[model samples]
Target: MREDFGASALLKIQELERKGAKLGMAQKILLAETGTVEQVLSILTGSPIRVNVTSQSEEKGVISREVVLTSDAGEPLIRARSKVYCRNLPPAVVEKIRRKRLGIGTAIFSAGLETFRKITKMGVNDGIPYRTYRIFYRGKVAFEIREEILLKGGPGGI
Candidate 1:
């Protein structure tokens, strides 16, 4: 936990999930301050979830994806750019992740695994955006997440 930099709700979610707890960021935001996880998606949306997979690639023992989660109306909500060490995850979980069926937190949590997230950077990119977080599993760097939350057309955008 990086005191001044980290403490974002995303981090909290990451902390909980890494401790074998399930994540419901969409719901948690409603209950507390998100610290520094950026304030773009600070407001949760009820819109239909949509995933725009920017890219999916695998090299060596790692598999990564750059995904944008948006509303059905095309309002970008959250960006989850991540890389996972395939060899470190269960095959079933990997299959689900590849099929775009489970989220990084959910995938790991469901597999009875926890994550360690370290926020390397934070700032606004497109809509209150920036770069943040490196997710770990059992002390091994399993995934790195770069996120951007789009505000326009989202929950509070309207």
Candidate 2:
């Protein structure tokens, strides 16, 4: 939540809120969903999604990355920032994550890892809607992700 969303994105969020748009079913599910977000977004939009890593850094065994999840048409859907704890994951899985070619969920699932999400927070703050959660593998916290829905057609269907 401390991350800057940039001026343009903040403007769009404010405008959507000003329009008094209602949250659609898809938006609601996004808020409460505990499953893979990429999968849920794909099903909701009826299109495959791709992960575009915006920036990444590693420090003290934690890998942090900022990414935008886009639809098949290349429309940005969700902006996410994740911190992966290397100590919580297997070496093989860590390698896949280091490659950064797949969504975090994709990497974990492809490796057939047993994981679950714990919602840490979800709500609109200063007109920006967001959800924050932690993914656990083998009962250890593996990743903490903060996501902001960026689709104008999402959130309130504007």
Candidate 3:
């Protein structure tokens, strides 16, 4: 039974790696739509302005903004948000990016699963308390999210 479980886990890891690559590609495409790394940073900074990205032919690509204003009681208010569109990107490129994003996601999930397995095994063999194991699992999830963000975007946007 243990051998079967191990084999299954290995297979999952392979699948995850493939998915992670796809996810990476997707992230690249999305970032590319912002024009430059500086532009992306600006958009993320909640500056109250609108940015309209355009293609080489001057066609509108995508629009980014720090706040979307709506009227209430005859007053305008800002709501922070950012968005991307397929129209701004080439169809082929969008498709490729989507595939890549999925791939990267898969890879990350596989790695996480593998780590969990190893930790669980150690806890079982060492007779560690179940409560301690649960704490480790919680820590793992928080660490994973942090690691993912860092890996996806370093100190600077690419």
Candidate 4:
């Protein structure tokens, strides 16, 4: 658990494109369309975040990591995993920045135009606490992402 946990959620949805869509997922969805991680989390869940490492390692030439992102009170909000090829990144920036502390937008900014390749897969179940996704980035699979939205009583009462 991270000691940096912050406050209560006052999140709300705003109309975009006049379509009345809500904030969705932990990927670049909000980071690209709405705002930064903190901004998106605050408006969507109205909560501060604490991250816990689930698993991490270097394998087959990439750094793989899994993390659980939770609210200050311990409600799981997002579970994300990423495989990044640090060698493909700038050496100077790589040395100065801490990778674990990066948010999706920041990572994209750092990598420069690293966009999503496709949504490889997705799943959801009512009894479960999370929704899963598998996303890939372009070019020799420079990065791949798998994330889960862990909010309870998901989206609607349904």
Q: Which candidate is the best by lDDT?
A: 2
Candidate 3 lDDT trough over 10 residues, lowest sum: 142-151
lDDT of 2 by residue, 70-154 (tens): 9999988899999999999999888887887889988988889989887777667554567788999889999999998776544
- Candidate 1 vs candidate 3: the TM-score winner is 1
Give the poorly placed runs of model 3, Cα more than 4 Å off. 1-83, 101-158
Worst 10 residues of 1 by lDDT: 30-39
Model 2 TM-score on a 0 to 1 scale: 0.81
- Estimate, for each residue in 22-121, the C-alpha lDDT of model 1 and write its tens digit: 3344434422332323232323555556667778988887787988776668876677778888887668878878887656665666677666666676
Q: Kindly indicate the candidate among 2 and 4 with the higher lDDT.
A: 2
RMSD of every prediction: 9.1, 8.2, 19.9, 11.0
Q: Once superposed on the true structure, which residue ranges of model 4 sit more than 4 Å away at CA? A: 1-39, 92-99, 110-114, 129-140, 154-158
- TM-score of predicted structure 3: 0.16
Q: Which segments of candidate 2 are over 4 A away from where they belong?
A: 1-22, 153-158
| Model 3: per-residue Cα lDDT over 48-158, one tens digit each | 323222211112443232322222222222222222233533355334323322221233343342223121211111211110111112224211110011113223422
Clashes of each: 6, 0, 17, 2
Residue lDDT tens for model 4, 70-140? 77788766677777676655554343233467554455566575554444443433333222223334444
